[model samples]
Target: MLRITTLLLILVAISSCSNKKTETEPLTAEHKAKIVGLSKDLIKSINDFDFSIVNSTWSNKAFKDRVSNITGTQKSVFEHIFEKDLKRKIKTGNLSIIHHINSTNGAASFFNLDHKDHHSELTILLTYNDNFNFFKYRIEIENQKPVLSDSYNFRDNLWYSEKIINSLRLASKHNAFSNDRRETNIAIHNSDQELLKGDTLEALYYLYDIPTTHQTGNWLSFRKLTLAQSLSDSVYASVMVTEYENNKSLYMKYLYHLYFSDSTDLEKVYDILSEELGESKTLDSLVSSGSFWD
Candidate 1:
């Protein structure tokens, strides 16, 4: 009787541990289905030029700080520019022209999801009319609803975090310890605005002239490389590659180098990029048209 009681207790403990493991598992099929549905709805809303869905998902702080500037009724430098441009394009029926170029209707292809505690990350291969880009969202559960805290855009082996803090930082009147740094930051911001407005050459030359002491970041140098690539100025791109030696994506650097190489080299690079990106036709169109935006 004593032996049987001991064995029973051990069995119960094992069962309890198994139950705990199940409870902590990141995502079950049902949760995944719900998340995917949310993602699809977000994409559809964007395609229709309804930004409400995008705004609705923003975390409390992101919503308050990202859409408007520090001053009253002044729109964010980043959001205002892009949102206005997108709305204009939609109104002018320019989306159809872009779609014709890519031969693809904008679609959301779910790539990955990682869940931890009340936080989750979702990465999707998003086709935004003319571009195939990766959209990654950092989501957190608040009031039992998923809200976006931040997002990162991955394009052509370069990464851009859509930071709302730039507006606040730029608006602040406080002087930095180094005046040179402050001026450089302002110059870079202006250059970014030009790039957003499609003044590629102006943006490239302006950024290129910043003093090396203040332009120490690899991202700054990489930005020049992208602009040069867009303009098909391989000579300038080669110079940028030397400055931006620590870029995370070596293959992307190689692709840029080969983009203006001999025909055989171009073919080989295209095959490698297509295999890696999984969007051969879209890439081909973008390259052929010589209008790859950052």
Candidate 2:
């Protein structure tokens, strides 16, 4: 009996040591629970189409802090959208709590929300404010087609991520990240004619001179230069690999349709986009033509 007792105590000591050595990051369970609660409240506000409920759930100071920045009628318009169709548009297909690399000042919870109807997935960023009083939430959506770019931010007015990218990378395997990733460059010599085009390096250069991107995952950011997705065969690429010979007008028209559709009167924006495309396409073609590639 004494031998058995000694053995049991040895096992208990081993169990304690193992538990102490486990690598779970340090965080107060109570604080973590609060973070989850706030995140849920924010999502619930959005799902129920109740912006007023947000006023109730969030601290008055935080509410004023966020809303005060909204200058005018834009607030009303923005509020209306959230109070109405925002939830109806994207359903919470799935949600999971993601750990933060370090939980210092406050907390950040990353969740993947599936909107199966739209064939889109949203990576929701819920960041607890300094006091853990409320959450500053932003959502980034990637569609079924898997586009990762910031170009649509101008059109959609929906903010993506400046944080929560690493967790996103862990979710998608095809996500590629490298400093060597080259953006397509299209340079214009004359406003009317292309000096050079096609930088094999960056797809964004093909999209624009300034590479503004939305997160495709953690490692990739892409913008939609052409709003419309064109069906390109190897034959098509071989025939007009150079910008001078490429169908720029057709591509532009397709892009216009992608963002504005056939009926939108947002022409000034489209004109700016078109002019930028002309410059980007030129540089891209010149770079892509090198013999290093087929």
Candidate 3:
């Protein structure tokens, strides 16, 4: 009887543990609801140009910490550059009013909850009238609240985290180029930063002041082409297409054209591009997406 009682107690304890594990195993529906709601709020903030609300939803501190870990103590400097330059540009009306948040949610995934770090990757389709773009956000839990930690735009094919780090590295190199070219570097960095924000025209405005000599490159040409394509400026896009096609340098290739060099790889790149960019305004299938890594 004693042995049977001990066995029964152990069994009960084991069952309780199993149930507890099961409870936390799946992403709770409540958590999913919170994430979806948070996404909508973020989109609204961006559309409204309320950087205060945008700042609240994003963990810039978390971003800085991550950047510090990777780039080593340059977070403050990078943040300063971003704030000063981008703000000045906005005040001057270079950046356009971001359009509405017309989006259709896609897949959402949850990962690394045990570490108290929740990576909620949500893919969604963002439409601006007839043109469509794919955007993905990686929402993470920081301080018991959900915040956007990183984002990836299908157009750029690069995450914002990567964009900032790269921008910081280049922008901080004061001796890398002459003063004029240094300004160009800053402008290029600013342009790519705007691209991350889904502002094609403002991004182009940053690039516009770049010296004519610095303007010609496979990467720059392709960047302009995609931005032009997004705005449906056929004439500008045609000029960019010509420049992109005629460029011979193999050095600094856009990710979009990297695959097109070979037949087998081209097919794979095509399928993914088609899916991400959707069918409308595909430049007649010549160029479906309209952004690239800088």
Candidate 4:
């Protein structure tokens, strides 16, 4: 009788543990729908330039704190920032939600922005507590989104760029014995000129096209390490590290590289270009004329 009771107790405990595991599993379809709905609503608010709606989407304290930190005021000053900094060049009609993903602790929405004369992308990330009350949110934009270096083709471009750079480096090392050193030098110069004439984002995109072999991992790791060493700004490093922690994607790393090379905030760079070239005009003229990096 005693043995039977002990066995029954063990069985019940095991069943209860299994049930708990099932209950704590990741998001279901219902959760996804809820997250997607929130994202769509936020995009709609942006299109309408309705701050009331935008204000409602964000947590009051978090939104206020961020605005205050940036503007040095506790009042709601996001409208001015949104208008001049973001919406000035944006074609609200072309804004569309491209993707949304939910994690155990939060969710993120990716948006494609086809501005009047250029294309860009935005990412909105939200983090919430267990009760589902979001405590923090962030919106990041990548201006002048590279045509060929988009998420779909980024890997291929990186692979190709890696091959080109590696070949050039190898040729230089063996140039002491090679009579064709002049040819290698010409190749290097031509490649540099090509890069100078191309979009900076596109140049960085080539890094993603490298083939994934055993050496690829080592090569990327070394590049990342080198990039970290090159950055003099601790704040930027901190931000990049946080972003990497949240989204461990190759595309994100590429964006970090671009940021490092440019050494300027993405939005500021866009704003400067917009002012110089006119917001109503297209970037095609500048992009086609010569490389902005040059």
Q: What is the TM-score of each candidate against the true structure?
A: 0.48, 0.22, 0.48, 0.20
What is the per-residue lDDT of model 1 for residues 160-190, given as tens digits with 9 covering 90 to 100? Answer: 2223334334444333656666667777888
In candidate 2, residue 133 scores what lDDT?
Answer: 14
Q: Lowest lDDT 10-mer window, candidate 2?
A: 143-152
Question: What is candidate 1's local distance difference test score?
Answer: 0.54
Pairwise TM-score winner, candidates 2 and 3: 3
Candidate 1, position 73, lDDT:
23
Q: What would you estimate as the lDDT of candidate 4?
A: 0.36
Q: Is candidate 1 or candidate 3 better by lDDT?
A: 1
Best by lDDT: 1
- Model 3: worst 10 consecutive residues (lDDT sum): 106-115
Clash statistics: count for each candidate: 0, 31, 0, 13
Better of 3 and 4 by TM-score: 3
Which stretches in model 1 have alpha-carbon errors above 4 Å?
A: 1-34, 62-105, 128-131, 155-179, 182-213, 216-219, 226-234, 246-294
**How do the candidates rank by lDDT, highest first?**
1, 3, 4, 2
What is candidate 1's TM-score against the reference? 0.48
Query: Residue 257, candidate 2: how far off, in angstroms?
Result: 24
lDDT of 4 at 81: 42
RMSD of each: 13.9, 21.6, 15.0, 22.1
